[model samples]
Target: MKILFLGDVVGRAGRDAIVARLPGLRRDLAADLVVLNAENASHGFGLAPDMARAFLEAGADVLTLGNHAWDRKEIVPYIEGEPRLIRPMNYPPGTPGRGATVVDLPGGRRALVLQVMARLFMEPLDDPFRAAQAELARHTLGASGSVQAIVVDIHGEATSEKQGFAHSFDGRVSLVAGTHTHVPTADHQVLEGGTAFISDAGMCGDYDSVIGMQKGGASIRFWRKVPSERLAPAEGEATICGVLVQTDDATGLATAIAPVRVGGRLSQALPS
Candidate 1:
C-alpha cells in the first residue's frame, strides 16, 4: 500500500497549494490513501467544517488534528460526526471527537489511522505511549483479517518525544509520522523493525513566513512578548510538505519512507 501523509495546512495559501497540486501528486506518487493534518488549516488555528470539507475534496482521505483541534468551537459537533476527521487520542476521556478511525481503502484494503499528542512541550493529557498501546491492542495489528496498514500521526512540539513514540511502535504499525511543529525534519527512514518514521513532516503553507505565519507579525510577538495582532499567512510561493510511505499488504510493514516537498524555496523532490 502507498500512503501520503501531509503535515499541517496553515491558511489560505496552504489550502490553495494543496488543492492546486494534490491530484497530480496522488497520481505521480501512486498513492492509495492520503492523510493530512488540518489542525491549522483555517487561518493557522483549528479547522472549520468548510475547510475540512475542502481538504477532503482536494484528495485528503482523512484529516488529523492536534493541540489546536478545539480552536474553532463550532467544529466540535462536526468533528464528532465526521468519521474521517480525527483528534488526539490522548485527549481527556470525555473529549468531543474520535482519536482514531478505520478507513477502507481501494481493493477492499483497510487502514487504521490514529492520532496522538505528546506531553513534552504540550498540554497535559493521557499518556500517549499507553494510549497507543491500548489502541494497537484493540486494533490487533498484523492480524489476518484486521486492517492492512496502520498509520499514526503524532502531533507535538518535541522531536525526542516523537522519536520515542516511533521506536515504541516499531514493527507494530506501518508508519509513525510527526506533525505540529510545521518544520520538516531531514531525517526520513524505515526503522529496523519496519516502521517508517519522521520527526516532523513540515507544513503546507508559505515558505517565506515564520513557521507559516507572517514573518513581520511573528517577529514582533517573539521580540516584544506583547500580544500582537492576529498572525496571517505569508504571501508568495506556497509548498506542500509531507512523507510518503510504501508498506506491504501481507505484513503491514513499511518497505520504504521518503520525504515529500513540493514548491517553495525548498528543493523539490517528486513523489514516488
Candidate 2:
C-alpha cells in the first residue's frame, strides 16, 4: 500500500496549493490513499466545510483535524454528514464527528485512518493511548486481515509525545506521522517493527513566515505579553510538505518511507 500523509494545512496559501497540486501529487507518488490534516485551513484556525469539500475533491481520501477542529462552527454539521473528515479520537464521548474512518480503495483493499491528540501542552482530553488501543482493537491488519494499512496522525506540541505514541503502536500500524507543529523534521525512518514514523510532516503553507503565520503579528506575542493584532497566514508561495510510505502487501507494514516537500522555501524532496 502506498500511503501519503500530509501535515496541517495553515490557511489560504496551504489550501490553494493542495487544491492545485494534489491531483498531480497523487499520480506522481502513486499513492493509494491520501490523508491530509486541514485543521488550520481557515485563516490559520479551524477548517471550513467548503475547504474540506475542496480537499476531498482534490484527491484527499480522508481529512484530519486537531484542537481547532471546531473552530469553524459550521463544520460541526458538515462533519456529521461527511465520514471522510475526522477529528481526534480522544475528544470527549459526545464530540460531533468520528475520529477514524475506513476507506475502501479501488483494488478491494481497505485503509484505516485515525488521528489522536497529545495532552502535553495541549488540550486535556481522553487518554490518547487508550483511545487508540480501543479503536484499533476492532480491526485486524494485514493482506488477509480486515484492512491492508493503517495510518495515524498524532497532532500535538511535544515531539516526545508523538514519538512515544508512534513507538507504542510501532508494529501494528503502517505509519504514524505527526502534525500541528508545522515545521518539518528530518527524522523520517521506519521503526524496528516496520512502522514508518516522523516527528512532524510540516504544514503545507509558506515557510517564509513563522510556522505559516505572518511573522510580524506572531512574533509580537513573544516580544510583549499583551494582546496583539490577529495573526494571519503568510500568503506567499506554499511548500506542500508530507511523507510517502510504502507498506508491504502481506503484512501491512512499511517497507520504505520518504519525506516530500514541493515548491516554496524548503529543499525539494520527492520519492525517486
Candidate 3:
C-alpha cells in the first residue's frame, strides 16, 4: 500500500495549496490512501467543515485533527456524521468524533488511520499509548488480515514522546508519523521493525514565517514575552510538506519512507 500523510494545514494558504496540488500528487505518486492533518486550517486554529469538505474532494481519504480539534464550534455536528474526519482517540470516551477509521480500498484491501495526542506539554487527555493499543487490538493487519496498512499519527510537542510511541508499536504498524511541531525534521527512515517514523511531517503552510505564522507578530511574542495580537497564517506561497510510505502487502510493514516538500521556501523533495 502507498500511503501519503500530510502535516497540519495552517489557513487559507495551506488549504489552497492542497486543493490545487493534492489531486496531481495523488495521481503522480499513485497513492492508495491520503491522510491530512487540518486542525489549523481555520485561521490557524480549528478546522471548518467547508475546509474539510474541500480537502476530501481534493483526494484526502481521511483527515486528522489535533489539540485544536474543537476550536471551531461548528465542527462538532459535522464530525458526528463524518467518519473520515477523526480527532485524537484518547479524548474522553464521549468525544464528538471517533479516533480511528477503516477505509476499504480497491481489491478488498483495507487501511486503518488513527491519531493520538501526546500529553507532555500538551493536553492531559487519556493515555494515548493505551488508547492506541486498545484500538489496534480490535483490528488485524497483513495481506490476509483485516487491514493491509495501519497509519498512526502521533500529534505531540515532544519528539522523545513521539519516538517512544512509534518504537513501542514499530512492528505492528505500517507508519507512525508525527505532527504539531510544524517544522520538518530530516530523519525520515524505516524502523528496524518495518514501521516508518519521522519526528514531524511539518506544516503545509508557508515556511517563510514562524512555523507558518506571520513573522512580525510571532517574533514579538518571543522578544516582548507578551501578547502581540493573535497569530495568523502567512499568506505567502505554501510549501506542502509530508511523507510518502510504501508498505509491504504481505506483512503490512513499511518498505520505504520518504519526505515530500514542494514549492514555497523549502528545497524540493519527491519520491523520484
Candidate 4:
C-alpha cells in the first residue's frame, strides 16, 4: 500500500493547493490513503467543519489535528460526529474526538491512523508513548490480520521526542511522520525495522513568510518584545509539503520513503 502524509496546513493557500493538486497527486502516485494534518487548515488556527468537509471531498481519507485541535469552538461537536476526523488521543479521557481509527482500503487491506501530541517542551498531556503503544496493540500488522498498514502522525515540538516515538514503533507502524513545526526536514528514510520516518513533513502553505505566518507581523513581534497583533497565514502561493511511504502489502512495513514538495518557494520533489 502507498500512503501520503501531509504536514500542517496554514490557511487559504494551503487549502487551495490541496484542493487544486491533491487529486492529481493521488492519481499520479496511486496512493491508497491520503492523510492530512488539518488543525491549521483554518486561518492559521483550528479547523472548521466546512474546511474538514472540503478536505474530505478533495480525497483525504483521515484528518489529524494537533495542539490547535480546539482552537475553534465549533469543532468540538462536529468532531464527535465525524469519525474520519481525529484529534490528539492523549487528551483528557473525555476529549470529544478519538485519537485512533482503522481505515479499510481496497483489496481487503486496512490502514491504522493514530495521532498523538508530545509532552516534552509543550503542554503536558498523557504519555504519548504509552498512548501510541496502546493504539498499536489494537491491530496486529501481519497476514493473520487484515490490517496491512499503519500511519502515525506525531504532532508536537522537540525533534528528539518525535524521533523517539518513531523508533519506539519502528518495526510496527508503516510510517511515523511529524508535524507542528511547519518546516520540512531532509531526513526521509526507511528504518531498519521497515518503518518510514521523517523528523517533520513541513507545512502546506506559503514559505515566503515566517513559518506560514505573515512576515511583517512576525518580524514586529520578534524584533521587539512587545505583544503584536495576532498572526495570520501568508496568502502567497503555497508549496504543499509532505512524505510518501510505500510499504510491503504482505507485512505492512515500509519499503521506501520520499519527500514531496510542489509549487511556491520550495524546490519541487516528486517520487515516481
Winner on TM-score between 1 and 2 is 2
- TM-score of every candidate relative to the true structure: 0.97, 0.99, 0.99, 0.98
- Candidates in order have lDDT scores of 0.91, 0.96, 0.95, 0.92
lDDT of 2 by residue, 1-272 (tens): 89999989999999999999999999989999999999999999999998999999999999999999998999999999999999999999999999999999988999999999999999999999999999899999999999999999999999999999999999999999999999999999999999999999999999999999999999989999999999999999999999999999999999999999999999999999
In model 4, which runs have C-alpha deviations exceeding 4 angstroms?
Answer: none
- Where is model 2 more than 4 Å wrong at Cα? none
Q: Order candidates by lDDT, high to low.
A: 2, 3, 4, 1
* Candidate 1 segments exceeding 4 Å error: none
For model 1, how many clashes? Answer: 0
Candidate 3 local lDDT, residue 95: 83
**Error at 78, model 3, angstroms:** 0.3
Pairs of residues clashing in candidate 1: none
Comparison by TM-score, 2 against 4, better one: 2
Worst 10 residues of 4 by lDDT: 137-146
Q: In candidate 3, what are the lDDT values of residues 159-233, reduced to their tens digit?
A: 999999999998999999999999999989999999999999999999989988999999998789766799989
Cα lDDT tens digits for candidate 4, 1-272? 88999999899999999989999898898999999999998999999999999899998999999999999999999999988899888998988989988897887778889899998888899999999888887789965665888899999899999998888999999999999999999989999899999999999999999999999998899689988899999999999999999988778899999999989999999997
